[model samples]
Target: MSLDTQSPGLLAEPQAVQATADGGTRLALRGDLLDFTHQPEWGAIESDAVRFREDHWLLIEDGRIVGAQPGSLAPDASWTRHDHRGRLILPGFIDTHVHSPQLDVIASHGTELLDWLNTYTFPAEKRYANLVEAETGAARFADALLAHGTTSAVVFPTVHKVSADALFAAARERGMRLITGKVLMDRHSPDGLRDEAPDFGARDCVDLIDRWHGVDRLAYAVTVRFAPTSSPGQLAMAGQLCTSMPGLYMQTHLAENRAEVKWVHELFPDARSYLDVYERAGLLNARAVFAHGIWLDDDDRALLRDSRAQIAHSPSSNLFLGSGLFNWRAADEANVRVSIATDVGGGTSLSLQRTIADAYKVQALQGERLTAWRGLHAATLGAAAGLSLNEEIGSLSEGCTADVCVWDWTQGSVAQRRHELARNLHERVFAWLTLSDERNLVTAYVRGIARYER
Candidate 1:
């Protein structure tokens, strides 16, 4: 199907057809179903309940999951069934931190945190000021996410309100659940990327929220570029936007690089730490998702836990930028919620599988292992919780949007050979996580409809 096909209604109804089994017509899954529930550690990790039947059935009617279980035959129910056997079914991956404007610069070279933004990131983002460019980029970005099995994302757009509008429009067109905001930076950014004033930025944000938020599956996030880029007035305005907009999510960078930390300390001398800058601005709260909490001190962790704010741990970006390893265990001990993310552009890959692999390696350096189940949970359910979007798009539960991904574990020669030696599900899952990239994604669905089917 072409990407420009007619956009569906907010709760679009799926087409209905008849299914047959045992010489009787009925509603059922077209093939075997594999579902994952609860991470291996169960209690230690977040609960991720899932259910899918083998050659079983899901009766989807009116764009909602009516039933999902194993049964012999039902002669009365009319439904169109999809056969997804030999494929793993899981919730669509939620990317907690990513820059939609950075789609073209994902693998650029050689600049540390702040330098990278000034050198390459900001200039690239400035292109989104044009509505046509923003729309095209938004469509491409959304397509890439769907192609890679990322069903939802908390995205950062350029400082232009049109950037957020373009992304939201594209997401709505594709029937995706996306949260995003126009980057608010009143100072310390290039001329084209900087806003006129804090109040003006706030006004634009309010406008975008009114237009986009709650329109279908989209949400609005109050995005601050970072403490260093935003003036005190701008930060306060971002805080005000958060306060005024109920259920709005807050996103910003924090303590990613050593030099960045030193700069933050120099800029906000009175604040207790880098996090304290946002905390004092009323920007820290339950719906807040801070990226790269690598340099967080003990008190910082405590404060994050106290506020119930979540962290988007971008291991790939941290490694690429030479930032220190994140202390996941320390954050865990402090009762902080953490989710894995690909801090793309700064992060090297768009593949959640690669992000999971990098996260496993990062944890290993800290003398810990992020298990296959735990990594998968972080990519899906855990990340959704971090974004405060768990109820809508996290797992394969009945009533949840049928955003699903099917993986071809043995797609490549290497994978096929590795599959031959794998003995168990866990081992196979581990191998896929470690070795699989975007090539392994066989098909991707958004809201019960196929967005990309390989």
Candidate 2:
């Protein structure tokens, strides 16, 4: 466990759907369509997994994908199409793990995971007890995410019910797909931040689940602060909630740092490894997402694969907090679902563009290359699949909500140069990951509605 820390074209304005003659709302965006059909290989780009079509039309009807048609379209008033031929369109980036409360603590100068939590993270989260504070913070956090071309995320709010509700309400107001829960830390935390002292905060979770979960594209997670902060009874209670609530997700930290792993061992002397603590508590499942799985043994990796739980690779946080680099290739080879995330506050930024660049550096340091296909897949469909929400979001398929981003490769002088120097689609797109940021985003849509723009 640890503490730590686009495009072009369209006008930067929100839009409401236009009505057709048949009394239905339709919006079609014409651009270069790109999305992953499946997870690509670890180091190399996969041809079959990628679906890239130039000058295609992504048809959206009533906020759902109807189809993606190719070639020129007839000038019909049945739908409104946004021309973005030079821009790229793909499923919005899905951040599997992040801290909404910790947004204030981002880039705060701190040493390591544990110390950073006590110093910057706790004080900031404590302020979330105020509804106004929580509401304002959540609004900024949600807006910041959309501004960076992320339409969906699994977030970590503070332990306060108000904090969790504020985030849910913010996402709801904007129609963004989001999942979050009140942080559960019954012990090992400051007075104001810990949950009602010692019962794992299940009652609060139930209250929040009833209020926010499954309401307007928002979901609830059984959020454990991490292994160190949660007592045995608390972890067991968290597991019980997962069992009682069929579709509820479980999120927490794992073997992120050397000291944290050692701490987990000390806390749970009978457990074989850090992951074993959660597994014994019945927390291992397909819906469970553990971040920073960098210290586990081969056996732990195998267990995670067999249990169908996923690991979120947070490279910037690992780098900023001095946590070790994650062996994403190893976990994928072991058949474990691995997704990339920002893990912000503990990480440095909410931009997945910068996060992926850091991921490439981290992977390259380990002698493995992260191709554009593999990296983008990890950010989008792979993350959605890991959270078992691939069918609902994260793709441009019929009936899925239209969470999409239109991006430009030629934003600034350097990106324009990179676009010119590129030889193929892969190279230019790879340059988008490295050379581009939120400024290149033309429009980011949540369910066919443009929520953010350049």
- Quick one: best TM-score, which candidate? 2
Residue 247, candidate 2: C-alpha displacement in angstroms: 0.6
Clashing pairs in 1: 29-57, 31-55, 32-55, 33-53
Model 2 spans with C-alpha error above 4 angstroms: 1-14
Candidate 2 per-residue C-alpha lDDT over 82-105 given as tens digits, one digit per residue, 9 for 90 to 100? 888878898999998999988888
Stretches off by above 4 angstroms in model 1 are 1-55, 71-77, 198-200
TM-score of each: 0.90, 0.95
lDDT of each: 0.79, 0.87
If candidate 2 were superposed on the true structure by all CA atoms, what would the RMSD be?
4.6
